[model samples]
Target: MNQELISHDGPGHRWLAERQVAGVKLGLERVKNLLKRMGDPQDTPAVAIVAGTNGKGSTSAMLAALCDEAGLQVGHFTSPHLVETRERYRVNGRCISAEQLDAALVHVRDCAGSDLAVTPFEVMAAAAYWLFRDLDLAVMEVGLGGRLDATNVTDPIVAVITQIARDHTRVLGDTLAAIAQEKVAVARQGRPVVMAHPTVTLAALRRIGLTCPVRKVGKDVQVQDVRIGGAGLGTQAVLRGRALSEPLQIELSLPGRHQLNNAAAAVLAYQEICAAWPKAWPDAVEVVWRLAEVPWPARLEVIETSPMMIVDGAHNTAGMRALAETMAERGKRWQVVLSVRDNRDPEPLIRELSAVSEGFWLPRMQADRMWDPHKLAEVIDLCAPHADVAVGSAQGCFEEARRQAHRSCGVVVTGSLYGIGEWLGRGEIVSPRLRRWLDGQAPQDQ
Candidate 1:
C-alpha cells in the first residue's frame, strides 16, 4: 500500500483504514446509534453544521477560528484532511492528539458493542462528539450530502451552506436543484440557515420544505468590493449583515474571491449561534475578523517559494473554476501536477487547469479510486489539444513540473486533497512529529 494514502501507521489509524473498503454509506442510522451508545455527547455543544459542494471546509475552519478568537471553547471537525486523519478534529485550533484519537476510538468501540457495523467516518464523528462534549461550540463539516451525513446527527444551533455545486452527483443527485435540496436539509425549522451559494434561491429552499429562516449572502448578508490580493495577500472584502451594526471589513487568509462569501457566511453563522445562546457568548464577545491568520491546509497552500509551488485541493469543476480564476488574476500560467479521483469528470477539470497551465503532469496519486495517469492524460488531450501534458509517478511529475516552472511560471499541485497528503508524506511540508508517525513510529515513541 502507498504509505501516503494510508492515514498514519498507528494501530488505530490502520484500523480506521481497514474500514475504508465499505466506502461511503450515506445514512444517519449507524452514526446516530453509535453516538446514542456513547451517551449522546452531541447534545451538549452549540453545533454549527456546514454543508456544501465546495468552500465548506474554509467556512467551518473560519467559523471555528472566529469562535476561538472570541475566547470560546470550540471544536472543529472537517474531512479529507491534507496532512493526517487526526486533522479532521480540532480543539481550540489544534488537532486532536494521536493518543487521544486512539483512546476515543477504543471507547467508541466499547460503546458500539460487537454487532453494530460502523464506517470509519461514523466512528470518527462519534469520537469527535465524545471528545468535544465539554466544548462551548462545535463546527462540524458534512462529509457528504447533508440529509444523511454522519454529522447530521447533531441538531445544530445554526447551519451553513457554502457554494453548493454539482459534485457528488451519484449520491447527492445529478441536478443542481437536487444537490441544493440535499444540502439545505441540515437546517432545522425555526433555526437560522446561512446560505452562501449564489445558485440556490430562497424560493427553491422553501419549495424543498425549508422552514428555517434563511440568511443568504447578497440578501441577508451583503459582501462588496471583493479584492483578490494575489496569492499570499489573501482576499479582501467589506461585509454587511444583520448581526453587524456597521459594515465589517474582512481579509481572509484563505485565497480566491470565492472565499469572500465563505467568510461572510462563517461570520454570520458565528453571530447567529451567539444570538441563539447569548449567555454562552457574552455581549462582550466581539466579532474578531482575524481570518487572515487562519491556516486551512491544501487550499491554495504555498509549500515552496523558489518556483512558487502552490498546492490546492480543487477536486471538482466548481473548485477548479475558482482556482483557475485565482491563477489568472496572478498573471502567470502554472506548470500543473494534477490527479483526480476516479469518480470525477476529468473534462472540466482538465479544461480549467489547461487555461492556467503552461504544461500538465498527470501523476499517479497514492489514494484509492484514482484516475489512471495515462488514461487521464487521454482526457487532457481532448480538453486542451494544444497543451503540453505528460504522465509519470508522483515524485517524478512534481520534480519535472518544478524544473519546468523554474523558468518564469509557477507550479500548482492540485486535483485532490489526498494528492496533497501524498506530497506531505514525501517530506514536502509535513511536520516532524507527523513525519515520524507517517514513518511507522508510534506517538509514544515519537
Candidate 2:
C-alpha cells in the first residue's frame, strides 16, 4: 500500500478504483482472512444479508430505515453507488463522511497488507464491516451472486432473497436453477430465510435444496391487496404471516408493484429479527411506518415533471420488464435513454424497452465496463427494427432524448446505474455535494 494514497480522501478513492483491474474475485476466503486479521469486526449478533438479482438495494434500505426507526444504530452496506463511494456505507440513512471513509480505507489497506490481493468491492465490504462494528444492527446487500459474495463472510441473523431472475449469468450460471442455488447460499442453517420470487425460482430453490427454514411470500408470508397508485402517490400492500400478530397494511413511498413484494420480504425479515430479540425493537406499527419512508433513489424516480425525466437502475431483463410494465400502466410511451454494462445482455432489455418506448437513445457510460454505444445501437436495431435510435455521449443522448420527447411523452433513463450516475453528473440533475466532489475529479466527456 502506498502511504501517500492512504493519507487523503481522493487518493484513497483512487486506490480503490485502481483495484478494479483485479476484477471481481468471487469467494469469501480473502474477505474472511482480512476480517480475521482485523480481529473479526464482522462478528455481530444483529446482521441481515440480502441477496437477489433485483430489489436487494431497496429491500436493504427499507430494512435499515425500519431498524433505525426502532431506535437501533443501523449500518447499511450497499453497492455501486450512484453519486459517491461513501454512499455504500451508511448509518441511519446518512452517508459516511469522506474523512471517515478515508480513515477506514487506511485501516483496510493495513489489514490487507502488501501481498494479499482483494478486489475494490471486497476492500469496501471489509471497510464497511469494520466501520459498523459499533452499530447496533447492520444490513448488508450482496454485491454479486450470494454464495461467494464478499458480504457473505458475515454470519447473518436473517437472510433475504428478492425476485431472482436471469442476471450475471456469466458468474452465477445460465439457468434460473443455477442462479437460485447461488442466491440461496446466503441462507444459513437454523436461521430464517425470506424470499419473494416467482414459482419457477422457488421450484429451482427446492431442486437445489436449502438447510435453513425458508418463508415464501404469498405462501408462508402473505402479501395481498397490492395497489400501485399514480405517480408520487406511492404503493399500498397488505402483509400477513406467522411473524405478525395480525394482517398489516404498508404504504411505501417507492413506486412500482414489484416494490410491494420487496416490502413483504423486508417486513418478514424484520419480524424474524424482532422475534429473536423482542426487546431490541419497537412495536410493529412503528416499524411498518418507517418502512414506508425509505427513500431508495433511482428506482422509477421521477426527477423532473415537465416532459418527465425518470431515472431507474434497471440493468437486467427482469428489471426492464418491470420498468416496461410500470410505464405501460402509466399510459406513456417513453423516449428512453438506455445504457448497459458490458457483462449484461442488451437484447432482452432492448426488446422490453421497445415494447413501451417511442424511441431509444443509446449512450456510452463513463465507466471502464460500459457497453459500446454503436454495438448497443446495433442490438437495438436488431431487436426493435421499427423504433428510432440515436447514439452519443451519456449527457448528449439524454439531452437529445429530452429534446425529442413530446409534451405528453416522458424520457426514461434506464439500464446501468453507472450510466444513470454519469447522466446525473451532467448538470441536468443537481446534487450539490456530489457535484462539488465530482468537479474536483478528472472530467469525463459524458
Candidate 3:
C-alpha cells in the first residue's frame, strides 16, 4: 500500500506487499482461500489462538513469554504494533528480525498474485505460520471479529477469549453474546476454549459448550487473587477439582486494572499446556514472574521528558476510562495527540479525554480510515473547550507540540494503535538522549 513497501524486503513488508483488496465482512473464505494456496501452513504448529474486545496483545505477549520461559522456541504474532510492523512477529520472546521478515515477505509476495482478493491479515497469518512452522509454540492474535478473523485459520490448542464488550458490534454483531459467539468460533476440538468473560458473557459461552470445552476464568481457573499496583497479581489455576498453586508472584510493568485478566488468561493457558504436555512446564514461580514482566506499547507507556511523551491505543470509551484512572493516579499536566478511525465512538471519547488533558492536537496518522484532522479538531473543540487545541496533519502538529514541550510539560499521542505505530516506527523521533539524561527530570504524561 506504500511506495517503499511495494516489493520491499522489510519486516512485515509482506503485509504491505500483499493485496489489501480483502473484503471486510465476517467470513473465513478469504483466509481459507489464502491458506489453501499456501499449502496449509497453519496446521503445522502447536497453536494457541487469542481473541477478545481488548487485551489480546498483552495476553499474546504473556503467552509468548511463558513459552520462552518453558525452554521452547515460541512465536507470537499480534496485530497493530506500537513501533515497528516486526513487533507483530516475535520468535522466542524476540521480534522477528527485519531480514528474516523480508525474506519471508519475498516468498509470500511472489506466490500471491494481484487477482487474489485476500486481506492483508490473511497474508500475515500465512506468513507467521510459514515462519513459525519450525517453532515449538505459537500464539496468534486475531485482527478483527474472531469468527472469520485471519488468525482463525489454525487449529488452536487453546482458544483464549479475553473479556468481551460492545466494541466492533457492527461487523461481529450487536449483542455481547453474539460477539462472544462470533469470537469463540476459533476454538478447536477438545482443547479448552478459555475466557475471562463476566457471568452473563460466560452464560453465552456456556451455550456453545456442547460443541467445545468452555473454560471460564473466574469459574474455571479463577484469578483467585491479585495484588493492587504494578507488582501484578497472585493467581490460582483451578480446573475441575484440581488447583495449581502459585510458585511465584506476577509483576506487571504495564498499568491498568484490566491487565490482571490478561495475566490470568496467560497463566491459565500455560497451565492448560502443562496439562497436555506436563514435561514442558516451567517452575511455577518462574512462570508467574515471566508473566509479570511483559512489555507492550501504548497501554500505559510513559516517555520520560519534561512534560512526558505518553502513547496509548485507547480507541474506545472503555479504554479512555482506563486511561483516565491511570493518569489521575500516576502523573499530571499533559497535552494530548489524538485521532480515530471510522466506526469508533469518537465524540464520547473526546469528551472523556479532554477533561484530563491541558491541550489537544489532532492529526492524520497514516490510516486510510482515520478521521480527518478538521473533523477531529471540531469534535475536540466542543468536548474540551477549556484546553488549547491545534489541528493539522499529525506530523506538523506533533512537530509543533515537540517545539512547545519543556521540562514542565508533556505530550500523549493516542486514539489509535495505527497512529502510534506509524509515529514510533517512522524512526523520526527516538529521543535517546531524553531517556539517558532527561529521564524524569521533566514533567511526563501519557
Sum up the clashes in candidate 2: 0
lDDT per residue for candidate 1 within 1-446, as digits (tens), equals 13232445666666666666656698999888888888999999889999999999989988888888777899989887656677777787777777778778778878877777888778888888999999999899998988888999877899998887888898888988888888888888788988887457455578677687777787767888888755363688888766577787787767888888888888888878778876766331255456776777678776677877777889898999988988887665678888787878888898887776778888776677888888988998888876688988776887888889877468887887666676776765443433443344422233
TM-score of each: 0.91, 0.90, 0.82
Off-target runs (Cα >4 Å) in candidate 3 are 1-18, 23-26, 82-84, 109-116, 209-213, 219-242, 278-280, 331-333, 364-368, 392-410, 426-446
Off by over 4 Å in 2: 1-11, 198-210, 241-243, 278-280, 393-396, 430-446
lDDT per residue for candidate 2 within 57-102, as digits (tens), equals 9899888877777778889898777766776777877777777897
Angstrom error at residue 368, model 2: 3.5
TM-score of 1: 0.91
Per-residue alpha-carbon lDDT of candidate 3 for residues 74-97, written as tens digits (9 for 90 to 100)? 888987655444556777655666
Off by over 4 Å in 1: 1-11, 198-201, 230-233, 241-243, 280-286, 428-446
Q: Evaluate residue 442 in candidate 3 and report its C-alpha lDDT on the 0 to 100 scale.
A: 13
> lDDT of all the models against the reference?
0.78, 0.77, 0.67
Q: Which candidate is the best by TM-score?
A: 1
In angstroms, the error of model 1 at 273 is: 1.3
Candidates ranked by lDDT? 1, 2, 3
